[model samples]
Target: MLSKRIISCLDVRNGKLAKSVKFVDTIDIGDPVVQAKKYYEEGLDELVFYDITASSDKRDIMLDVVSSVAEQVFIPFSVGGGLRTVEDCSRVLLAGAEKINVNSAAVRRPELIREAADAFGSQAVVLSMDVLRVEPRPGLENGYEIVIEGGRRRMGIDAIEWAKRGEELGAGELVINSIDADGTKEGYELTLTRMISEAVSIPIIASGGGGTPEHLYDVLTEGKADAALVASMLHYDEYSIDEIKDYLIGRGLKIRKA
Candidate 1:
């Protein structure tokens, strides 16, 4: 079995890294370039940098910051936020992102997914879904809607169906971020994560609410996730990357131990 990956996320806003609960109540953390360097030195499997407000604010991702961090980190890095056009995708790729994550833009123009995959191959594109469970609309049976626009807009789309569609559209992987569970550290949304994992052949990275090493264990072992994306725990110094890897290794999960 391939070793499960421990990825540290850097949420950048105005060139500064930040974190929030359920995608709101934002607090500044620090410079993303510094944080990226720190995680790389800590021996993390990969790094994810999100221009957290870019999509919602309708602006381009910070290329200067992206370039700076990309220059510093040796590990594979994935970048997201406000990437809407083929040119937008190319700019970031040239700036040094190994993979480009598209969220609201993809939903708005799924052709962008196909275009990106055609231009850069599916392996270079990651479709990120910021999902929240909402009451089924009138005339619909019991079901939840997939919210978008950084979790602020309701799209009336089913989350499971969306994942399937993303796979069909040639998305190499999916990052399912649970808005309800984000930053709570309670745990990942296992049911949703498992459902998406089983529904799609591509790897799924489970995000949100990972507060403990056990949370990571449960998500990989039971939730059926390919990897776990952690932010607050690692950012606050609650746990080190080596410590998390050791715990997963002790639990019989495959992980690279340094």
Candidate 2:
């Protein structure tokens, strides 16, 4: 089996690292560059830097911050938010991000995914979906709807269908971010994770609600996720990358050693 990945997430808003609950009530944590360097030195497998407010604020990502983090961390990383076109993807890749993730923009114009894949290869494009669980209704299969613009707007699109479409459009990977489970620290939305993982063959990185090593283990094994995207647990110093990796390794999950 391929080794499961543990990814550290840096959510930036207005040039500072921040964390939020259910995509609101964001609080600034610290400098992203410093944090990125710390994780890199600690031997994180990968990193994901999101310009949190870029989509909601309708502004481009802070390229300077992306460059700073990229320079500090040599491991492969991805950048997301406010990436609306192929030109934007070029700018981010030129700035040193190995992958470009599209959320709000991709939902608005899915061809952007094809365009990005064509220009930079599917491996360079990642489709990020912000999803929330709602009461089961007649038509909203799985009862999860896709939200965009930093979870400020609900697109009313079925989450599973969107994931399959994203893959068809050549997105090499998908980040299934569970808004309700985000920052809760209970665990990943396993049902949602498993459902999507079974639906798409492309690697899916389970994001949100990872609190303990067990949570990571469950997501990768029982939940069938390819990776776990951790934020609060790592951002708040609740655990280090090595600690998490050690636990996963101890639990029989393959992980890269520092």
**lDDT, residue 226, candidate 1:** 96
In the range 1-258, model 1's lDDT, one tens digit per residue, is 688988888888877889877776889978889989988998898888888664444334478887887888898888888888988889888899899999999988888998999999999999999888666666322254577776899787888888888888889999999988987899998988998899899999999999999999999979999999999999999999988999999989999764
Across 85-160, the per-residue lDDT of candidate 2 in tens digits comes to 8998998899899999999999999999999999999999999999989886765767999998778898889999
lDDT of each: 0.86, 0.89
Superposed Cα RMSD, model 2: 1.8
Provide the lDDT at 75 for model 2.
92
Best candidate according to lDDT? 2
Runs off by more than 4 Å, candidate 2: 54-61
Query: How close to the true structure is residue 186 of candidate 1, measured as C-alpha lDDT?
Result: 98
| lDDT value, candidate 1, whole model | 0.86
Give all TM-scores, in the order shown: 0.94, 0.95
